[model samples]
Target: MQDVRVIPPYPEANEDGIREGKSKSSKFSFNFNLKPKEVKAHLDKYVIKQDDAKKTLAIAICDHYNHVAECIKREREQGDSKSDSDEEYTKQNVLLIGPTGVGKTYLIKTLAKLIGVPFVKADATKFSETGYVGGNVEDIIRDLVTEAEGNVDVAKYGMVFIDEIDKIASAANLIGKDVSGRGVQTGLL
Candidate 1:
């Protein structure tokens, strides 16, 4: 391995500046393996005046790929897991936080399409807290599993977007109904 110091030439001790140099400890990076032109194509679909978020995520995806590629190369040299090498894929998930109609949902759907993954959308509000008194919270996962039934390939490597999640803010006394909001987040996790 080459010994090229990764530390800054002139260290600036600011809060924003990275104190320590990059290390191999953080090998866990998520990547979808999208090409440069394909990335540009996806970004182009969105409207103008909002290139910052798009560019940041795009670069982040590329950086993640680079990091994982480096690890893969080292693993090949050391003869590591064969399955990972054969199936070059990474489960990279992202969350969008913004107001409605700001294209947050559109971004997830567009990204899924760009990456050729099965995109699934769900409304968290429509789900009731009273699942017949005995029903559990795992129905969310069951619903997702059902959604991706026929498309196994894409389902294995796809996206699920939950909208209107702010509906059940308080499950303890939801509109005078004894529902559980915490249960939903727990089920989601």
Candidate 2:
């Protein structure tokens, strides 16, 4: 598909705003005549390892496009009457739990990188129960918003990794909660 530039009129013209023949707004738009597989092939040249994670992200992007395509088809069939996202099939929200340093963090981050989505990694230990002294739980979201960048507005639509969840149960005990060995089962559950 080709895009034609219909530049809006600017009352004022400066060297920085309009140089040679093109306006500054054209810089924000991108034009590419390339296949996705070709782009992936090029990215692979620089990104080493994590090929599976990269491919999974590629599939996810493809699925998003598939969903959009399906939406377009539905609009075509129905003409003016169309259903919103609430009426359509939704994607599943996933929770990933595993041992430490098992690529849980890396997998999410790699997926974000491959697909250009925002991502946040938070430790459950940061949040305390009831009267525990530390930063607020909402701060996590706030931090994520401040940390987000690029074409990826991940803070609005992204993934989160909650680490060290087991510690939440372990820390709940004040003194005698762990002496009976019941804490282990209480935690692993």
Candidate 3:
């Protein structure tokens, strides 16, 4: 048989070719083969301030994608005969709250680029309630699909940044439910 090399699911970090792992010697457990510090460092290059947000998002992204990479690895090793279990993988969706032009979109966009993943941005204000004449919330998913070249599986794994999410908050003076806002939020959920 010809010799075959099995490459690791994740590439080694930096130019040293040394792989990072969880160890009692280290202060933090770098899960999914990703070092959170490295991620934060990359964020620092493009973003200024928001250190807390950067750290939080870095950890979250590392955790989420590491889980996904582990899932893919498990499925590949175990073949396609898996069954649905009581618990399933849950995505950690982030909601960025800040004033306009605070680099909310820029932060996410930069992180996506750094991770080499497809990024989709949509304004929550642009989407109208169902049965209305404006854009649909599902359009974000559709855009992701397009970004992935019509591959549903690829699109599902990508990031969709819906800006201006706070605009959907219900008005205090309204008596009943805000159908338009509520409808869009429900659809997104």
Cα lDDT of all candidates, in order?
A: 0.51, 0.45, 0.67
lDDT-superior candidate, 1 or 2: 1
With a 3 Å backbone cut-off (N, CA, C), the pairs that clash in candidate 1 are 171-181
Local accuracy of candidate 2 as per-residue lDDT tens digits, 2-41? 2222222221222222111123232221111223463345
lDDT of candidate model 2 versus the reference: 0.45
**Residue-level lDDT tens digits of model 1 in 1-189:** 222122221122313221211222322222244554455456666645456657655665555544555555566677763455446655345556667777767766666555433466877665555464543445555554555454332243445778877775665545654344665566666
Best by TM-score: 3
Using lDDT as the measure, what is the rank order of every candidate, best first?
Answer: 3, 1, 2
| Cα shift from native, residue 176, model 1 (Å) | 9.2
Steric clash count of candidate 1: 1
Model 3 spans > 4 angstroms off: 1-33, 80-90, 171-179
Worst ten in a row by lDDT for model 3: 1-10
**lDDT top scorer:** 3
Question: TM-score for each prediction?
Answer: 0.53, 0.45, 0.74
The C-alpha local distance difference test score for the whole of candidate 3 amounts to 0.67
Model 3 lDDT tens row, 46-105? 789999889989988887877766665566678652336415756677778788888889
What value does the lDDT take at residue 54 in candidate 2?
46
Model 1: how large is the Cα RMSD against the reference? 14.6
